[model samples]
Target: MSGELRVIATAGHVDHGKSSLIMRMTGMDPDRWAEEKRRGLTIDLGYAWCTLPSGREIGFVDVPGHERFVGNMLAGVGPVQLVLFVVAADEGWKPQSEEHLQILDVLGVAGGVVALTKRDLVDEETLAIATEEVLERIAGTVLAGAPVIPVSAGTGAGVDALVAALDTLLAAAPAPEPARTRLFVDRVFTIKGAGTVATGTLTGGCLSTSQTVEAYPTGRRTRVRGLQTHKHDEAKACPVTRLAANLIGAERDDLARGHVLAEPGSWRPTTVFDVTIRPVRDLERIPSRGAFKVYAGAAEVDAKIRLLDEPFARVRTAQPLVLDVFDRFVVRESGRQRTVGGGTVLDVGPPRAADPRHRSFLARRAAAARGDLPALLIEERGAVRADDVVLLTGGEPPTPHDGWCVAPTVRHAVRDAVHDLLGAFHRLEPLEEGAPLGVVRQAAGDAARRAGAPRAAGLPDTLLDLLASEGSIVRTSTTVRLATHRVALEERADDVRALLERISGEHEALPPTVKELLRAGTPRDVIDAASRAGTVVRLSPDLVVAPSLVDRAVALVHQHAADGITVSTLREALGTSRKFAVPLAEWLDAQGITRRRGDVRFPRED
Candidate 1:
C-alpha cells in the first residue's frame, strides 16, 4: 500500500542548522533565495520534500528563526501537525528554541522530533549533555516525550537514524479527513507562463486542477490551471500535503502572504470572534484589554482583546480572518514580541448586543462555547436557517422544515403569541372574522423583544404559514385568525339583519345605501359590523346588499355570459332604475366577475 503524505515544519534559533538539516535529509536546497545562500541564513519560508525508507513522503517547511522574522516562522508552523525542532549540539539551548517551543504549544502541535545538529563540533559526552538539556526544555511542552537524534549535516552523521525516526513519528500521526479545503498562502510569485502561483500547506479537503477557488477576506476569484505536490505534477492535491497551484485570471501582486485560498462559499470572513484563552503560565498578567497580534492558519492580524470574565474574551481583529469553531490562535502583545495567550475560537461572527453587560449577552456567549444549537434556538425565539446553525457550531445541520429550523420553545412562543393576539382581537370585535395578518406579526415581534428573546426579522410569515398548514390557524390572502374563530354579532344585530333582508327581498339588484341605513337610525357601527361579519356585502360606498342577493345577481350574470348582458337588460330583469343599476354593474366589473365592453358586460374568464 502507498503511504500517506505528511508535512513537518522546522524551528530553532537563527543559524541553528534548520536549513542544513533539511538539505541533508532531502538532498534539496530549501533556501530558494540567492541572498539566503550567501548570508547562510533562511530569510523566509522554504519548502523541500523526501520519501522515507518506508516510501512515506514527508514534506518540510524551513522557517526563518531570527527575532525580526518570528512572524515568518509562525506562518510556517501554524498549519502543520508535526515539527522537526532543530538545536545546534554546540549550543545546548537558545532563546529562539524556547520561543519556537512556546509557539508550537500555542498552536497546539501534537507531535514532533528534536534534531541536535552540528554533532561533529562536539564530543560524545558533550552531545549527551546537549540532548539532556533539550529533553528538559521540552519536558512540559507538546514535544514532552519526543525523541532526540544527534546529527551533523556537514558530515552526514546520524542522518539515517533521523530519517528512520521521522518515519516512525509519521506512522502514528492521524490521517486527514475530507472537509472544506483551505490553503493558507505562505508564498505568492509570478511564473513566466503561469500567471500566478501560490504555495502553502493544504489542509481540510482536496484541490484539483480546473477547480475554481476564492481568495478570502479579499473575495478575489481565480481558477486553478495546474497543481503540484512535492515537485511532481498532480491532478489533485489532498489535505496535509504541500501544494503549489498555478492560478489563472489574477496577477501575483493581487495575492499576499496572509490571504487564504478556499473553495468558494466554503468559508466566511469574520472580524470579531468569541474565544476561550489560556494565558501563558509565565506571564505576569493577561493582556486582557489592549492591542495584540493574533496568529492562526498563516494569517497574522492586529487585534484588541476584551475580557468578558476569566478565560473568555472577545477579539476584534483589524483584518477579517477566515476561521471556524475550534480553530486555534496565538496572541502576542503588540510591540512586545512576547507570547501572552492563545485560545480556540468558539464563535465567528458572534451575535451583537446593544449592551454587553446584559445577562442575555453573557448567556449567549456561554451557549456559543458549549455549541448548544437548541439553546441558540431558544434565544432566537423564532425560526433560524439550518445553514446558520451549522456555521456557528461546526456540527451537523439541524433538522429543518421549509429551509428553517425552529426550536420547540421558540415555536411554542410564536404559537402562544398568535393565540393570545387572536383571542384579544376576537374579544374586541366579536362580529369580525379575525385580525389583519400584519397586526398579528407586529404583536409577535413586540412580545419577543419584551421577553429578551431573539426576534429574527421577517420570520412571522414562516410561523404563520406553518401554523396554518397544521390547522392551528386560518390564513387567507389578506387576514389570519384562529381556526375556531367565527363572527359573533351584538344584540342589535337582529334589527339590522331584518332591514337588509327586507331591502334585498324587495329589490334583488340594488339594496339600500349605507347613508340610507344611518339616516333610518341604524347605527353605522352596526352596519360596519354586519359587513365585516359577511352578513352584509358592500359593493360600493352607496350600495349595501345581502350576500344572498349578490350571489343571485352573480348567477344571473353567469347565465348571460355566453354573449353579453346590457345595463338596460339587467335593470329590467331586477326592476331597478338606472341610478342603482349603474353602480352595481360597475362593482361587478371591479370584482372581476364581469368585463364591460361599451355598454354590455360579459362574465370574466378568469
Candidate 2:
C-alpha cells in the first residue's frame, strides 16, 4: 500500500453491517475484541486497510454504531475527513444513523459514500424506498451528493461497484496539508518487548522513526522507536493515515485514549477557549449553562459553556486539551446523554471578561479565513513577541517590527498617550529638569492599561528609546523629557534671581541652608529652578552654595601642594560650621575636584 494514503471511518447503527461491510471490502476482521465477535456488535474501534483499484491505499476505522457507545464512535471519527456511512437496507434509518450523520456534519467531514448494506434481506421496491429515505435525511448535510451504493456481504453482490465508488471519492479528495505532526491516541498498550505502543489516525504531518514527541495534557516526552502503517514498517509515515507508533519514554499507564502525541513543544494544552457553536440541525436551543463534555480529536472532557454572544461562547474544560483555532468539536450534555451541539474553536486564549473589544475580535476571527488569523491576532493583541506569534498561529507574523509583531494603530495610540503624560508632568513640575525614568515607565504602564493592552506594557521602554534616538524626546541617563520641555522661571524669576545673589554675596562662604531659605519665604520651586539652571549648586539635600564659591574652594585646596587639607582647615577657610564644610568637601571629592585621604583632602589631577 503505497502512492498515497487516505483514512475513512465506517459509521451507522448497531448490527447495520458496518463491520461486515469492512470485512468484505478489505478481507479482514474488524471486530478486534472477542466479545464483539461473539455478540456481533462493535463495542469499541476496529482497524483494517486495503489498496483500491487506482493503486491508492485506504485505511478503515470501524466505529461502534450503538447509542451507548457514541463516545467511542466519536473518538474514531474525530480526526478523519471521510466517512463510509452504512444504513441497512432492511433497517432503513435508525436513531443511531441520524446521530452519526450529525456527528460527521459537525466534524466537517468533506465527502463520503453511503453503504446501504444487507441488500439481500430487502426486496427491490423496499431497497428503493430505504435509499430515498437516506437521501431525504441527508438533503442539506455534507454527504448530500455522496453516492449511495447497495451492497451485500453475505451474497457478495455489488461489492465491486462499492470499491469503484470509493476509488472515485479518493481521487477527488484534496491533498493533506503539511502541518506540524499530531497523532491522537485512541488506543494505548504495551507490546511484549517493544514497550508502550499507541495507535491512531495521524493527520497533521509526517512522523519519522526516532522523532521526539510529547504527550499532551500530561506533557510527557517520548521518542518514536518504530513506525508502522497498516502493519508495514516505514522510516517515515505521512499524515491522513492510520499509524501505530512504538514509544519509549512513558509507561502504558501514563498514556490513555484521549491523550495526544504531538511534536515536542509544538502544542499548548488549554483549559479554556472561545468558540462559534451552533445547535444541532433539528435542536431549537442548547443549554446556556450546565456541564457538557467537549469531544475533539479523540479526546473528551467535562466542559462548561458561557454564551458571550450569539453562536459564540467560552468553554472551560475540566482538563486541558490540545486544541487549536478552527478545530471542530462536539458538545454533549452529560445529564441528557445526547450531543446538543458542536462548534469551531475560535480562540485558545480569551480575556477574562467578554468586553466589547473582545467580542469584536472574536467576530473577525470567525469571519476570516485560516491563513488570515495570525494577522488578526496581532491586531487584537496590540503587540506580541515575534516568536510567540509563530507558536500561537503556527506561522510567521505579518510585517513584524523590530522583532515584535505590533498593530500600527495601537502603537500610535500609545505614543500619543506618552506625549500627553509628559506634557502634564512638565506643567505640574516646571522646577524639575525631567521626570525620573521609573516615573515615566509607571505612566507608560498606566497608559497601556487605559488603551486595553496591558500585555504590551513592556513595549513603552523600547518605543521611548526609539523616539529619543529619532530626536522626538530628550533621554538622559536617569530621566525622560519632551524635546520642547524646559524648566522656566516664569513669575518666580525675580525670587530665584534674588536667592542666587544672596548665595554668591553675603553668604558666599556659608550659604543659607535650604531649610532656612524655605523658612524665610523663599519658595522651594524657585530655589530648585535656580539650582537646575546651574545658578546655584547643591552640596547636599539640605545645603546650597554658589558656583563661584565652589571654584574658590578648589583653588584653596590646590594651594596646599605639600599636603592635603583637613576638614577643620576647610571649615576655617570657609568660616562655616562642620555641617556645611563636611558636605561641601564631600561634594568636591565627588566632582573629582579634590581627593580625600582619611583626614586630608587634595586637588585631583586629570
Candidate 3:
C-alpha cells in the first residue's frame, strides 16, 4: 500500500500474547531469535508489518514483556509515537504491565490503544471485570480514555476491529516533521553478502540510499549502501517507519546495539544533560545521587543523578549519548527492577554552574523547563540554529539570518559595550585614532562581567557589523572607535601649525625630512602632532612633507610630463636634494599620480 507509514510498539507483561497478536495481524512471525522461539519468550526486539484496509502501512515493534528485558522494550518504545498496550483478559493486569504503563507515562507517550488480549480464555463476565480493571489502571495515564478492544489471536476474533481502530488512530496522529534524520540502532548484524546492517524505527527526518551517516558514541563514518522499509527495498525512507540499512565502512563488531546512525553533524554526543524528571508517583523512594541505568532511544548507559531544584536533575552518563533537547529518557536504579523516573532532556550539553543550587542557576533551569528558548540563548550569549530552537521548545522554526539566530538583547548589549569602550579609549588616549579591536573586545567582556551581564566568549562579526550600521561605532580593518571620535593634539598645537606653515611656504616644490626638522630645533612631538593633524604627511620613516608642498611637487611633475621625469631631474627642477626628492617621487608613483618606467616617471594618462 502506497500510503503513510507508522510504527506501533507493543507493550505488556510476559506471556500476554503480544507476539501472537502481531503475528496474526501481520501474517509474519515477529520473533527472530531461535532461543526466543525455543523458550516461547521474546528475548529481544522483533519486527513485523501489515497494510491496513485503508491503505496505511503499519510497522510493529514487538518488545520483550519479561521484567529483565525492559531495556529492550524501552529501546523500541522510545522512538515510536503510537503504542499498542496489551493486557491479557484472563490475567487481568500483571506487575510488568503496571511497570510498562509507568514507563510509558514517564516517557510522555501521548497516544495509544489498550488491547485486552486472550479474550477466548475468559468468560463474558470475567472479560467485563478484566476490562473494567484495565480501564481503571490507565485512567490517569497516557492511555486514559483510550479505546480498549478485546481480541483473541487463536480464534481470530476482533482482529478486523483492531485494525479499524488502528486506522482511525493513524489518521489522527500528527505526522513527524522533516528534521535531521536519526535512527537508533537496536539491532546490528552482518549478512552473507551485505557488510553491516542496522535496524531501528527511524524518526526526526528521512534517510536516502548512498547518504553518509555517522555512528554516534564511536563517531565512525559510514555510507548507506541500501535501504529497506517494511521488507521492501526503497530508495529513501521517511520517519515513523521501520528501516534496515546496509552500511559500508564499518564492520559488525564496530557497530552494536545502542549506537545511533544519523545524518552527519546532525547530532552530538553528550555526557551531561539538564532534565526535569517526575518520579513514578508510587515509587518507594525519590531518585537520589547514585549509579543508575538510563534508557533513551535504544541506548542504555550507567549514569549518576544530582538534583537541581524540584522536578529537575543533572544526569551525567558514563558514556556520551547522542541526544537532543526534549528527548525523553527512562531511569532505573542500579540494581532495581522497576523504573525510578523519567524526564525530557532540557539541555543536551549544559554548562557547569559555579553553584548549581544558586538561585539564579535554578531560575534559569526552571525557565528552560518551561520552554523559554530565548532565555537559554541569552544565557549562552551565542548564536544557535533554528533546529536547536525547534528541539528545545517544540515550536516551529524561527526566522534566522545566516543560519544562526542571536537574541536581540545580546546584540544590543554588545553594541553598548563597544560604544562604552570606544568612549573610554578616546578619554585615555586622545592622540591615538582608536583602540585595536581586540583590546576593545577584551574591555567589553570585562564591562559585561562587571555589570552582571552574561559574558560571551567573543563578539560575533555580524553583531559588530550591526553596531557599525547603527552609526554608534566606526570599524576599520584593524581598529574600532566611536563615530564622533577625533584625534586631538594636546601639546605643541601652535608651534606645530606654525612650523608646518613656514615649511610649506619656504619649500613649495619639496618638503624637508624629519631629521632636518629636528636639526632646525623643532620638537619631535611638534612634528608628530603636525602629521597626526594632517597638516603634514609622513611619506616614509625618513621623509615628512607638508600637504601643500606635495601638491606643488605634483604640479611640477605634470609640467615636465612631455619629457618624463627622473629623481635627479625632479631634484634639479625643485632645487632640492636627491634624498628629499627620491621619497617624493616614490610617493607620487604609489599614489598613481605618476607611472614609473625604468628610472623615469611619467604623468598618469588618466
Top candidate, metric TM-score: 3
RMSD of each: 3.7, 5.0, 3.3
Per-residue C-alpha lDDT of model 1 across residues 286-338, encoded as one tens digit per residue: 76566799998889999998877666778899999988776788888877888
Q: Write the per-residue lDDT of candidate 2 for residues 511-538, one digit (tens) a residue.
A: 7889989998788988877777887898
**What are the TM-scores, per candidate, against the unseen true structure?**
0.87, 0.80, 0.90
The TM-score between candidate 2 and the true structure equals 0.80
Candidate closer to the true structure by lDDT (higher is better), 2 or 3: 2
Give per-residue lDDT, candidate 1, residue 398: 63
The lDDT of model 1 is 0.81
Clashing pairs in 1: none
User: lDDT per prediction?
Assistant: 0.81, 0.86, 0.80
Error of 1 at 40 (Å): 2.0
Least accurate 10 contiguous residues by lDDT in model 3: 354-363
